[model samples]
Target: MSHTFDDQTHGADITRLFPEQATDTRSHPSRPKRGDLAASTADALAAAGAATLICTGHCKSEIQHVIDHISRKYKKVNMVFVTADTSSLASFHEAGRTIKKMGLQIDGFIGFPSVMAVPWEMTGDGHESHFQRNYLCYFLLVNILLDDMVHGSRVVLVTSCVRTEAPAPTWVDVRFSNGEDYHCLEGYSQSMLAMILFAKSLSKMCGDRSIAAFSANPGNTKTNVQTYISMDQMESWLERKRIEGEEIPVSLQQTPKSLAQGSATILRGLLDPDLQEESGAFLNHCQALKLPHLDFPAGEESAQALWRRSQEFLGAFL
Candidate 1:
C-alpha cells in the first residue's frame, strides 16, 4: 500500500514560485523552476569576486557543457569543475588538497554526488560502495574543508524519499555484508538514511562555527544515477516490497520530475535565507518535512553513533 508522508502535494510545482530569483530563466525556457537560485547566488559571489566550487564524479562532459554555457551567458559568474572518484577515500583527500591548493574559501557547497541501486560491492577502501561514496565521502570532504568554509556557509546533502522506505539499519552489521542476503536497495537506503543522520550530526557539530547542514529530497527525477540498475532488478525489488508489506509512498512512484523540478528542493536548502535556523532539517518539495512516522532510529544518539563509526572508518585520513 502507498502512504502520503506530508500534507503538501508530492512533486508540486515549486520551480516557478521564485521567478524573480532565477538568474537565466529567459535563456532556457524549459529550465526547472527555481533552477537559477544557484546561478543567482553564484552571480552574487562573482560580484564579490568569490570563487564557487562544483564537484562531479563521472558526468564530467555534461557538467562542462553547462559550465561553458553559464560562462558564456553570465560573464560575472566563473565556474570550475573538479573530478573526484568517490569510490576511493584517498581521492577525497586528494580532492581536499587540490581545492586547498586553489586557495578558495567556500561559501556554498551542495553534495549531490551519489550512486543508487547498484549491485552490492566494496570500494577500494574496503567499505560498501554506497556507504563510502554516498555518505562517507561527503563526510570526509566536508570535514577536510571545514576550516576553509567561511562562517555562515551552507552545506546541502541531496537525500531522497527512499530514505523513508529504509528498514531499520542493523548498526552492528552496518556494511550489510556482500553475502547472499544482501539487496542493493538496502545499501542505497542505508546510505540515504545515513545522509540524514549525518546532516543532523553535522549541524550540531558545526553549530558553533556557523556552518549549516541539510538533507534534501529532490522528489523523483530520473538521472544517470539509475544507469546501473537493470529492469529485472527493479521489477523484482518492487514485487518483493509488495509481498513483504512494505510502505511504498505514492509521491516517489507518482511523477517523474524534470531536472529543474528535481533540483528545486536542493536549491531551496542551499539558497533560502529563511532556513538559516533550520539546519539539519529534511527538505522536500521546497518545504521542510517532519517525518514522525519513519520506522527507524534516526535520532540524536544514532547520529552520534554514525558519526563515531564514520570517523573510525576513515581514521587514516582524519
Candidate 2:
C-alpha cells in the first residue's frame, strides 16, 4: 500500500516515530543488534559460532553490503550467498541440497523473498503465482531445511498488514478460479495470511526442538515488493483501504516506515531475546499484536486447514 502520512503528527522526520537501532551501508539497517551493537545475520551467527543459511531475492546488493560489513567487523563469521528464485520449485530443491552439502547447521533462517500485487498467473510448479511464490515455495524450503534448524533457532516469515486490510482468503478457493475472481490485493493478502498461519504451524510442529517461528509485519517501506504495483492499482487499493480503515492515507501501511524501520521489526523476531517465549506470535512494528484473524475460533480452524493442505501439496518436497 498507501504511504501517505499526516504531516502534522510525524513532522518532517518519519524515522523519528519509527526509530532504527543501527545504520548499515543501505538506507535500511542490516539487522537490529541484540545489545548495543548493530545486528545482522553475520553478527548473530558469529555470536553463536554457528552456521546459517540465508535465502534472499531482489536484495542481493544489500546482502553483499552486509557480507562486506561482516568481513570488516565480524571477521570470524563466514557468509555464503546462493541464488535461488522462490518463484521456482526446482530452484529451492537445488538450494536445499547445496546447503546440505555444505553441512551447514542452520542457526537462523530469515525468508525475505515475496512479491505483491502481481497479475495472476500459474507458476511452472502448477500453482497460483502468488501462492507458489509467496507462500508455498517457502513452505517447502523450510520443511526441506527443517533437519538443519537446531534447537532454539529462529525463523522469520515476513508478512504485511495488508493481510488484515484485504478480503480474507476463501479457504475453499485460495488459489482462485483460474484468476477469474482474483484481485491482486486479495491474492497478495491471502499469501500473507497463509504465512502468518504457517508460522504458527511451524512453531507447533517443532515442539521440543524449540525452533521458534514468527511472522513479522515490517510495516510499510518503499521496496521492490511494490515493483509490480502500477499507479492505477495503487490508487484503487488506497481508496479501498481508506474506506475500510476510514482514515486519511489509510492505516494499513502504518505511516510508511523507513527501510531501516521496516528491517527492525524483522530483526526483532530473529534476535530479540524478549520474544523467546512468544513463538508463533505475529510481530507488528516489533511488538506482538493480536490480529483479528488469529483471535477468533474460525481463524484457528482456517490456519489448521491451511497447514494440512500445504503439507499435502508440498508433501513431495518435504
Candidate 3:
C-alpha cells in the first residue's frame, strides 16, 4: 500500500520541516488555490488518464490537498500519496522496493523538494549537509528506479538559479564542513549547483539508455519553498546589503509567479514534443534559460566531480 503522513501530527516541528509555513498550517497565505503549475501538471496527467504518485514527504496535508483539489477537477487520476520522507538514501530504497511490490510503472518522475536557507543542517545518515538532502535523496531514488523505467522515461528535478547567487564550492569541503564560515546561501548555492551538474552528468549516463534527465527552474513563484526566509531575517539581510551597498537578491525582491505559471515550465519540458529530442536541458519559465549571465555546467570535470560525490554518498545503491 502507498504511504500517507499528515502534517497536522508534527504540530510544532512542522515549522522547522516547512520553515515557510504560515500561522495557519491548514492554509497558507501565499499558497494559491488554483493556477499553480504543480496542480496543473497533476491535472494534465489525470486528463491523459495517467496515474500520479504524490510524495507528500514532510508536508502531507498541503500536497494531499493539492492532489485532491486538482484530482477533483481532472479525471481522478490514480495517485498514490507517498508519506515517507525522501531525506535519506535508505528511504529511497525502501520506497523503490515498495513500488516494485505493488507492480507500479513510472513514466515521469518529478521532484519539487527543498528546504530552508539557514545554516547547514547535517543528515543523520551520512552527516552530509541538509542542502544536499533534497537533491541526493531524489538522485538515489532515480538510480534505484532506472531499471524499472521503460525507454522514454523522463526525470525532471525542480532546481533553482539562486545557486548562481553564491560562489563555487571548494572540492574538499563541498559538504560544508565549515558551513558557519559561509553565508546562508553559499552552501545552498553549492548544493543547487551540484544539481545542475548532476542533471548534465545524468544525461551523459543515459546515453543509449533512452532515458532523459532535465533540471527545471520554475522561476520565482510565491511558493513555500522560500518560506524558510522569515520576515525578520529578510529585514536583517536587507539592512546588511544596504550597509554593504549590495542590491537585494531579485528572488527576494520580486513577486513570485502563480503556481500555474511555474508548473507550466516543467510541463513544457516533460510533455512538449518540441523538447522530445532535448536532454540535459535547463529550463526557466518553460524555455531554455539562455541568459548569458547565468552559467550552465562548464565542462565534464565539475559534472564528474558532482557525480562522483553523489555516487560516493549513495555507494552500491547506485
Candidate 4:
C-alpha cells in the first residue's frame, strides 16, 4: 500500500525504450476497443506466422471479445486463455471449474492449488494479518506459471507491482526451498527475479525457437482487485488520493484509459514481429525495460537455480 519509491534504484535508460509501431496503423487507430485490439493483434501475429495465442488473468470477457473479433476478421487464428488466480487455491480451483463448464479446451495450465505464504512470511512479523494473504497471492501465481512451461508454447505471465520502497508489513523470516530466509520485501523481489530467470531458462532449454517468456505489469487501473482491500484501508487510500498527487501523476491517472487500454502493451509484445528474437527481457507498455541487473548474470545458470527451487516447492503437480 505504500507508494513511496524513496529507497528504490532506477538505472534503466528510459530514452532507449519505445513501443513498436503497428503494421496496419488504421486497424489500431488510437485506443481501440478490446475487440479491435484483439483483431489487429491476431492479424499481425498471423501475418507473422505465430502458431498460438496465450493470455493470462481473469479478463475473459475482454479476451473473448478480442478473439471473436479476430475470428470474424481473420477466420482462422487459434487462441487460448490460461485462467489463474494468484490469490488462493480455492479461487484457482473455482476458475478451473468455470473454464471446464464453459467447455473451452485449454491447451495448458499454470495455477496453484493454494496460496503461497512466502511473501507474507517474509515481510516481517507482528503486522496486519491481512497483508500476509494479500501480497502472497502474487508469488503463488508466478510460481504456478513458471512450473508449467511447455517447450513449444508462447508463455505470458501477468503480475501486479509492489512498490519497491514500501515496508513489507507482515512476517519476514520464511525459508524458501533453497534454504534461504529472506527479509524485507525480498520475497516479492525474488518472485519477480524468478520470473525473469525462468523465462531465460525456458528460452535456453528450448533452443530459443521453441519457447518465449515475458512478464508484464498492468499498471494501476480500475479492477476488481481493489475489492480485496479492507474498507478502512480503502477509505485511507481515498483520503490520501489527491487531484494532483505525488503518488500518481494526475495526467497519467486521469487519462481516458481502462484496464483494456493498459493491456494493449501486453498485446503488442505478444504480436510484434520485432520481439520474436528478443527473449529474457521485461516489458512494459510494449517496450523492453531494463531489469535491475542482478549479481548473477541472466542465463541458463540462474534459470536452473530458480527452476530447481520452484519445482521443489511446487512439488509433483507441476
Candidate 5:
C-alpha cells in the first residue's frame, strides 16, 4: 500500500530533531508565491542584463506562471521552456531540443533535478549521502552548463537542503559501481563535494568567463519532498524517538515551506549583484555561506575518476 507523510508531521519531526537550530520564524523573508518566481527571474535578468532564459523542471505550471508573469511585467526579455526529467541526461537533451524549438537565443539555463540520490555506503563514513546525490545532480547540470558556456551562455545550478544536522528518515539505498551501498550520510557528503568540485573546475576552466556556479540552500519550506517517506516509516521513526524521550511536537511535522519559499534563495543567487564576485561559492538563505565540511573532496583526480567510471558503467549512454 502507498503511504504518505504530511508536511506538518515532517516539519514537527525536523524541529524536534534540532530544537535549537530549527526556529519557528519563517525561513524566507521575501517568500514569493507559487507563480512569482517568473517575476523574480525577470527582475534578476534585468539586473544582470540577460536577454533570455531557459528553465528545466516538472513544475511546468509554476514555471510557466513565472514566465507569464515576466512577460506581463517585463515584456522585453525572451523566455524558453524546456521540460525534462533532469535525473536523466537523455531528459536534459530532450529539454534542450524543446528549447531550440522556442526560437530564442538561450542566454542562460537553470537546472533543477527532481530528487537527490547517492550510493548508500557513503553514509557510514560520516558523510551526508543525500548531499552526494545532490552534488552529482549539480555535476550533470554543470556539464550541460559548461557546454553552454563554451557556446557563450550563462547557467545557474538550483538546489535545496534535504538533510540537516538533525536526524531524518532515509528512504533510499543508492549503490555505486564499486559494489558499495551508501546510506544517506555518505550521499549528502558526496553530493556537496561534487558541487564544490564542479564549481572549482568551472572557475578554473573558464577563468573569468566561466559560467557562474552558485549553490543555494533554502531554509525550511513546505514542499512534497517528504512524500518519499511514508506515514508508517515516520511513525516508526517517531516511536523510536519517543522511547528516547525526544521532545518533538506533532505541529512541527508540517511540510517544508512552499516551493516559492524554498526557491527564494535560488532566485536570489540568480539575481544578486554581489554574486558576480562570489560565483563559485554556495549561498544559504540567499547569503553567501561557507561550504560545509565534506567527508570527501571532489578533487580533479577524483572527478576524472568518477566520470570515467560512470561512463564505463553507463556504457553507450555516456
Candidate 6:
C-alpha cells in the first residue's frame, strides 16, 4: 500500500490533491457550501447558471489536475470540483451531508474511485475490502445524492472494458468484507459487472426522475490504477500492442495519458449532449456502445436483484 488514508488529509501527495474549498463542512459562509461542476454549462454558463458535478474519489493530485485543465479550457463553464473519498460509508455521509447542506443543483456526477489488487485486503480505513471500495461504495454514492440531482441530471460511472473481458460472478452479493478470494481478476471483474448492473438498475429505478445513469470505458488511457499490476503483466500487454498497430499504456505499468488526455473521457461522459438518450448505456471511447452478454441475470430481474442487494448493504444510508 504505497498510499492510504483514514479521514486525515495527506499533504503534497498527488493522491491527496483535493481543493481546500471542498472540505466536508456546512454553513461556512465561505465553504461549500460544497460541490463539483461540468462542461455542459455553455447555455448554463451564458445564463450564468451554476451546474454542479460531484466527483468523488481519493486521488487528489489527479482530480485537481483534471479540474484545473477543464476550468482553463472551458472558461465559460463554471466547473467546481467537490472532491471526497467515496471508499466508505462515513466519508460518503460526510460528503453527502456537506453537499446537501450546500443545496447546489447537481447536474452531473463522475465516479472514478476504484481499485484492483494482487490479493484481497481492507481499504484505507479498514471498513471495507478492496472490492467494496472499488464497487459497492459507488452504489452508496449514487443512492446518497440521487435526490439532489434534478431531472435530466447525468451520471457516468467510469469502469474498465474488463467487465466484458472477464467472467461474471456466480452470485450478486454486494459485501466483499468476508475476507475471501475467488481469484484476483475474477473478483475485480465482478465488481465491474456490478457497475453495469447498478447503472441498469438505477436507470430503471429512476425512470420517473429522468436521471440518466451510464457506465464509461475510458479506452485504456492511464492513471494510477496500473501500479497494482506487476510489471510482467504490463510488459506482456505492451508486447501484444507492439505486434499490432495499437499502443496502450500498460507497458511495465506505464500510462500513455497526459493530464489533459486523462480528463477527456470524463469530460465526454459529463458534457456530451448526445448521451442524453443513452441512459443505462455503456460508453466505450465516449460513445454509446452495445452491452456485452450478461451471463448472470438480465432485464429488471438483474436490476431488481442489484437494487435489493444495494438496499441490504447501503440500507442504513438510504
> TM-score of each candidate?
0.77, 0.74, 0.73, 0.45, 0.54, 0.65
Pick the winner on TM-score between candidates 1 and 4: 1
Residue 114 accuracy (lDDT) in model 1: 60
lDDT of 5 by residue, 1-318 (tens): 122223222222222332322221111111122433333433444333345545555556746666676566656655555555434455544554554455443334444423433234333322233533344434444454343343333344554442332232222323433335433323433454455445545545555564455655544443333444455644654565577676444443443555445545555444334456666665555566554331123244554555554344334332
> How many clashing residue pairs are found in candidate 3?
7
Over the stretch 212-250, how does candidate 3's per-residue lDDT look in tens digits?
777777666665346467666566655766686766664
Pairs clashing in candidate 1? 15-33, 15-34, 32-260
Query: What TM-score does prediction 4 earn?
Result: 0.45
Summing lDDT over every window of 10 consecutive residues in candidate 1, give the lowest-scoring window.
24-33
lDDT of 5: 0.43
Instruction: Look at candidate 2 and tell me the lDDT of residue 194.
Output: 87
Report the lDDT tens digits of candidate 4 across residue range 56-170: 4444564566656655665544555555434344443444444446443222222111122132342232222222233233333433433334343344444344332222221
Question: Against the unseen true structure, what C-alpha lDDT does each candidate score?
Answer: 0.62, 0.62, 0.56, 0.39, 0.43, 0.51
| Model 3 poorest 10 in a row by lDDT | 21-30
The RMSD (Cα, Å) of candidate 5 is: 12.1
Residue 286, candidate 3: alpha-carbon lDDT: 59
Error of 1 at 240 (Å): 4.7
RMSD score of candidate 1 (Å):
6.7
- How far out, in Å, is residue 124 in model 2? 0.8
